[model samples]
Target: MKISAAARFRRALLIGAAALASLAPLAPAQADGLPDPGFQIVQGQTALLVTDPQNDFLSPNGVAWGVVGKNVEANGTIGHIDQLFAAAKSSGMPVFISPHYYYPTDHGWRFEGALEALMHHIGMFDRKGQLTTEGFEGSGADWLAQYKHYINDGQTVVTSPHKVFGPETNDLVLQLRKRGISKVIIAGMSANLCTEAHMRELLEQGFEVMVVSDATAAAQLPGMDGYAAALANFRMIANHVADTGTVVGAIRANHHK
Candidate 1:
């Protein structure tokens, strides 16, 4: 039987695809020799660190909502963070919020990065001024209404806003060190940006950091999946990356024990 050239080409393509598929694992563990140094929540020594839990990153009307809202909803980030807050408060564990804010003076910077420029252009986390709370209520820089109860409680340590992605320029390290917090459970908005940055800096500062996998989300652009990227980094870099339910369970179990 004489086979047609086009039919032969099709057969070759199918064979190539099948060969490629066969080369791939049915279920890759993705942890090729990676070690997960698990974290244990301890009273007084462990704290909850939430980054950028403000309207700009967590609210529907935020400027960056169009880019990040999908992931936020998919991960149930808002409710998860609320749960962490409640757990921390009930457990008598300290809660630290590393907020992100940009005052009017910040806009006059001579140079900025890509996201910085975009954030400035879009007015994300823009506040009236540092000295006054005027027009701050319900603004992008303001805390999400639901989180206000937890954050404004006299106990929660709200650090100065981190202007950039990380806590390098902020007093987060000082606050943590002063409180003798050696372990931190981190969660919050825009997973790849502020949340991940906080994790990295805290780890560098000698804090055993565990990132809440679903309690944080990120912007998903056409070619970029910020959430996926952040997830990969969290698994590879943090002491442990667990889902909200697991983390919440651990917190409750630790406190109840």
Candidate 2:
């Protein structure tokens, strides 16, 4: 027996509905064609990429203190980054530290950019040598004591040290890719420099990035407000720009739910 024309149309419509239903769960669909524009902290696929959480940037007694101290204090950057670490730990998200450390030979380079020359001149983030896994103590290259427990050996994934600015100079991208992390939640020093560089590079590499704005600080200059400039760029290009509290809340919800 042959099927009726109306019956064939109904069968085709059912098959089309089933095909769409299968594809629906492949990726999230937003009504307005907007990327999930809300805070999305994917539990295991997203890792926290904190750049240069070191004494030179976060502590009062370090070399960059003169430049970044006031902003650090005003923004409570130290506590905010710590808060992010704590939440990531509780939520079981990978915490990757992309540190900046300069060795003795780095200062010997004859040619340097403005910030590179300035950092060498100021003796910022100067480590004795790169041969040791143990970082220096009470030095510009050291991790703030408050963060040792979290970033210590075997406790966290510390990517290769980046000499100048971004994750491109280090193994950060490699580590993230190896761990299947395609989304990064970033925070840490000099909002316009390293943190901004991380954001730019990660986006170029096709990863979705969210920046914790208040968890990072920047050096204030006579006319240039570094953090403000970074915040603007993050708002324009990042998948999301959120504060510490907002991030922490999302982390909790993602992990617990």
Per-model TM against the reference: 0.87, 0.84
Give model 2's TM-score versus the native structure. 0.84
Using lDDT, give the best candidate's number. Answer: 1
Best by TM-score: 1
Per residue, candidate 2 scores C-alpha lDDT tens digits across 1-257 of: 99999999999999998987776675345564434354576767899988999988888888888888998999889999999999999889999999998888888898988999999998898887888645588788889999999998476999888878888889999999999999999999889999999999999999999999899989889998888899888877788888899999989888888
For model 2 the local lDDT of residue 48 reads 93
Clashes of each: 1, 0
Segments of candidate 1 deviating more than 4 angstroms: 1-32
Alpha-carbon shift of residue 78 in model 1 (angstroms): 0.9
Model 2: residues >4 Å from true position, as ranges? 1-36, 133-135
- Cα-based lDDT for every prediction: 0.90, 0.87
